[model samples]
Target: MTDESESMETTNDESQKPESQGRMQILDHALSQARKKIISSAKLQLFQKHLRPIHKKNPEVLKRMHMQLTKQLDCHISEEVMLMFAEEQMEKILDDLDGVIASQKDNKEEAWRPSGDPQQDSRVYNISVKVKQKAQLQHVLSQLEQQNTLLRDHVALRQKKLLGTKRTVDSGISKWREINEAATSIPADELVEFVQKYGKIHRHHTMIPWDDDIDVLVNGSQKEAMSRALESLPEYTLYRPPLVQWKFFSKNITRSKRPFAWPYIDIFFFGENETHIWDKANRYTQLYMFRKADVFPLQNKPYQGSLQPVPCNSPRVLSRTYDPTLCTTSSYTHKEERSKDPGSRKTVKCESLYRKFPFVFRETRDHYVMETVKVGDCILYQTKAALPCWTESP
Candidate 1:
């Protein structure tokens, strides 16, 4: 039994020895690989250190060395490990390269100097510092130029607005002066007689500065006479409408820029109908009928520093034609006053509608009525009547 046990123990020892030999072989192979990897890393680091000075001058040497190192460490080291070492070596090489470039730049700058005196060196250093400072100043100057350009544009815009306002004011003054001159041209007796025979000057402020077109009214009988009188004047040009009243444009008074185009004075003519006053130019046949005596006996009123003919009962005439509230109110600036004045709001609507559908309806003293034509189907016809009486009072 002892001999059998000893033989069995020997067999077990033999099996254990083979397992230990396999592990030893593995360790030896791993150590050899580790040593090779360390050697390759050391070589790469040394090569990179020497490569910086000649990197620009001898690029072929760097390429050959890179190829050899890659071939030697290809499978011996993991790809990640090799890349990490390569990256570290590359960073060191870049740092050394930067240092060498800086030293070369300094050598070139020193070579350009005429002398190595302390003051000369200080001047060179100051010149470099000033170059940097000049660059900074140039950047700031560019920004300021942009800001200045914007400021100039803003100023130009404001100047344009101011000039436009000035031109408007000057034109308004010139127009007002022309209108005043035209109104004063007519003889006082003829003006008074015309006003008494027809209608008074409406919305003529006696003691205020009026900057609007001059308004005149005449009856059918006086229309030809007034037109002849206006046409006789050298400064006035009579604009005769087909069915409407005539307008008097001033030949002498023209815009500052436009010499041929002139501003005109409005002349309103009224024709008495069965129930209302008809205005051919305004296309409105309906207007409050006034007694001949109510608008007669014209009174002189101050208009732009001159006396002009006005109705004897101007307030009554205004109230009858336009709004009753206008007689009580001195100004029409307030919202409440404007709201109370139907003529002001209705006039705009009527004008807008008239422009849209010019021949649809005719206004009577009471309301608007559709105008009927003698067609087979009785079509509505628009009249070309000019209602100067609808002008708003200030």
Candidate 2:
């Protein structure tokens, strides 16, 4: 009986051995899978950390890739796909990390090679830095130029809309009537002459079919009185331009038709020197040195259905200042011809230079004078009293 019992126990122990071995095998497999998963996760984390800096520094590269993919595939790709692609590429690159490091070190050593002369090396480095900075500045300038071009295009569109509309003849007639009424407010004694009288209402021969702005010549002595009288009128508002010229516009008018189609007047003052009639607002530039008999005398001329004071010798003065044939003709286009003419080239150049370097010139009632002098640059006007006012370059 003791031998049979021992045999049963031995058999039971042998049967339990296979079950325990199977459990041990299952535990070993689970641990192997967990180790592999942890290693993959750590590798992914390392890839992401390395790629983050590259993405931040080279955003345009990603944008270009996205655009190319969108165009090539003819489908919109989400941000996730691009990121996944980048991660895969980064992982491949990191697989050869030792090679990459070796190449980078070689490049860095070559770039930072020191010459025998410290000064020469320093100069080379400075020049390289300056070149890089210049490249960056040029890129910024290109962006600014694009923005400026867009702004200019927008402004041109607005101008086209403003200029395309035409004012009616009736509206023009009404505007002229309003202008005449406003002119009547100025006292007769303060008025000197009417200039640029080209409308149908003037007694003098009309040149242009359409009436433009009215230009009035007032006595230089009585300019203050004229200003006061014009200001007192409720119909007009006074605007002063540079050079002390007065421009009167209708109070109710908008800026869209300003100076050209609006009911307005430009007042120019003239003073007589020893021999010449000088424009007070134009740095006392000589207008004319007329003979005693040819001097302009104030005379009443019909203008806008009202009598206004004007120069009696307007024909003579106009002939002297403008081409008689062109001025008298009803339909003449001289602007293009004048611009192309060689005789006006010098004047155009001087005007352009003056506009470009306004700071270099000083304006006075007597004359326009240059405030600076240099060896190569020409001083157009020089006076004994004028002093050099050269500003240092910043």
Candidate 3:
């Protein structure tokens, strides 16, 4: 009996050993992460303190610095490195200021020294010192401004490169996939679905390139539920528009409320009836309209390596939303918030789309005709007085 009990105890001890080891490993990892967080917080505090005076003198520079810091932080860089870079910048500014101050002081002494007229000398010396300090401060501020601009450009270039990388683009798209999966928890009748929108055209052009945001369409009724669900998500923060409009409502979901929250999602709430669905007619001169069949019976479309539920007839929906010619032509995206400068716009050919789809063209000396291809057939033709427009031969 004694031998059996000892054997049982030994077996129990062996069984618990693996579990105990796992617990220790987890604990160690937690501690390490906690230490990093503490150190990062301290460094950030110190950096902010260094900028406090500069912020008081020139708030705009401080704002730009904060923006740069936000972008770098998003890149998963260590706060220690950022702090060091900031210190170097501050040091340079100080060095420039020191040199200017020294030169001004030397000049002041030579030009306005103690004279026989004490009162006059005192007034001139005070005014000179004030003017010298002002000039020195301005000079230092300009240097700092230029350095900030260069830093901003460098970080922006690095950021652009990072975003263009396949891994980063995949990661960004995966986030939308997660949101799509989470949205499925809602019932089908409520109509929560991701739509291709402008991104649909890009599918023919590029291999799921990084997009600024994703578009989601939900029934007007599901607004509250979606708001609650998105808020519950750890990765998403839902923002509702400030003003309420008839038949128009949207929720903007962002990763964070930072200065450069690039990749986000827009959830547009649509009003529906038995025959048709529409959004924001009063707000938009050309409201988006769709037949009930165009949206119902949501179909899965391949997007960014995942099969996301999209409107059944995406091309039809897009045609109604944007100019039909947009399918054949490519141009820089125009957003309401962006500057409306014609010089900034460029027209480019949808080479990928043109290649993938068949089209017939007619060329003449004065004009050309081009036909729009849909579903492997030439459907419509348009004439233009430019380089040979490809027109569908009837």
| Global local distance difference test of model 1 | 0.50
Please report the TM-score between candidate 3 and the true structure: 0.40
Which candidate should be chosen as best, given TM-score against the real structure?
A: 3
What does candidate 2's lDDT look like per residue over 56-136, in tens digits? Answer: 787556545544543443222224444664777744554466466657875644446787899999999999899999999
Write down the lDDT of every candidate, Cα atoms only: 0.50, 0.50, 0.54
Off by over 4 Å in 1: 1-172, 189-215, 219-221, 232-236, 250-264, 270-288, 292-308, 324-394
Model 1 over residues 146-178: C-alpha lDDT tens digits? Answer: 999999999999999999999977765665555
- TM-score of the candidate numbered 1? 0.33
Ranking by TM-score: 3, 2, 1
* lDDT by residue for model 3 (329-373), tens: 222341322443566544444443554554333344434323233
RMSD of each: 28.7, 28.5, 30.8
Clash tally, candidates in order = 11, 0, 7
